[model samples]
Target: MTTLDSGERRRGSDTRPLITELIDEGTVESIAQEAWISLVGEDEVLVPLPGGPATDPVSSWVDVVGPWTGSVVLTTGRRTAEELTRALLREHSPAVLEEEDVADAFGEIANVVGGNVKAALPGPSGLSLPDVGSAPALRNPADLCRVELQWRGEPVSISVQGALPPLPAPR
Candidate 1:
């Protein structure tokens, strides 16, 4: 049997699809809605309306790597995040919420949303643990899939953006 050439066996240049190509606003909204209902409250509904930019914004995200690599980010106002924590904890919530409570709840939300987003993408992927704080800078605008939503009159945005910068131009 003849040996195959290495060049012939090499994978074609950057065949991976962008986040926008793989996911849409509606799919992302649906995923967020399900997460809200399950984690925040059964009665809570994420209105698919742009409530404008968030005030005192805080973000939580989880990285996904595989056929596609990116971060699934959730951003909302600090007050809204605190409220979400309260909603999540229900009777377990203290009258005065702590920073740690907000972080844990918000991080959990990102984990749930990110997990679903990862599942929807092409398989054999790995998801990183959730992180809370500032949102990661968007690397490639074209590689982003975002959805704007309102929860209890608060603006929230979910963005799935590539972690790596755009590939260099072809020679």
Candidate 2:
């Protein structure tokens, strides 16, 4: 799949299963519990991941697996990740994850979590990578359909925007 946003064309080529399937496996295996599911999109969310307010200002990770690719980035915020973490793990022991973990969570969310949903697309031509990151003014995937879920009250956004056109598998 190839995507065009902000004048940049991202080319992707993979032929594997869907991202949602991967997410199901991870969610079941991983300790993170399954939360609510929403069908629809939303406007740009200025909310950044909660974590460190220092040196590790931000970090992003991206990877391509099977029919899709993903990226994730750790972030920080005014509310503080600790508070957000508490809310997310509210059902659990509460202190389960720290703010720093939020970015990693975001990255993983973009990867397996976001991947699972994006993979649901009909064609094999999907995304290039799950980019986990922060800073540089995160681009909004407004064009694609997205879903929002909350973990301990914190919002985890999942987007399934498609590539430009010629929605065919890459060679």
Candidate 3:
């Protein structure tokens, strides 16, 4: 078999764009706004302001794999998550919400946002089912796009971060 020159770059090596390059805070906010309108309530709006840090934070995310592999994560306080669950359920919500209820609703929000984010990226991508719990570690700082907002006066943050670590600098 014939081999290429030493300096030649391999196909599919270091070609994927970082998450920040592919998406921005505005696009992410619009996506989240649409999701909120559809899933939360017709009048619900996400105020585009940093609401500071969340207390007793909970997160939901979905993994995306394709030309770029990463996760789309949504985080908020536990009480806020419960409120979001109620809003999603609307009149169907029970007086006493269960942990599973919050998980299901919050995870669904992440799924919707992640699906849209995946569509925005260069495709032939695979999306994982949503997972709810702690946020995934930020593996590569350069590969992240994050937005902070307030929904019903509660803090919520959405972060799209690469799963892969940063590539080594060339010698």
Please, what is the TM-score per model? 0.91, 0.34, 0.93
- What C-alpha RMSD separates each model from the true structure? 2.7, 12.4, 2.6
lDDT of 3 at 54: 98
Off by over 4 Å in 3: 1-8, 11-13
Residue 63, candidate 3: C-alpha displacement in angstroms: 0.5
Cα miss at 150, model 3 (Å)?
0.5
Q: Which stretches of candidate 1 lie over 4 Å from their true place?
A: 1-11
Go through the candidates in order and give each one's C-alpha lDDT.
Answer: 0.92, 0.37, 0.94
Candidate 3 per-residue C-alpha lDDT over 1-171 given as tens digits, one digit per residue, 9 for 90 to 100 = 998677537634656689877889999999999999999988999999999999999999999999889999999999999999999998999989999999999999999999999999999999999999999999999999999999989899999999999887765
Candidate number that wins on lDDT, 2 or 3: 3
Task: Compose the digit string of candidate 1's lDDT tens values, residues 7-62.
Answer: 63354554568888888888999999999999988899999998899999999999
Q: Give the C-alpha miss distance for residue 73 in model 2, angstroms.
A: 10
Error of 2 at 60 (Å): 7.4
Order of quality (lDDT): 3, 1, 2
Worst 10 residues of 2 by lDDT: 35-44
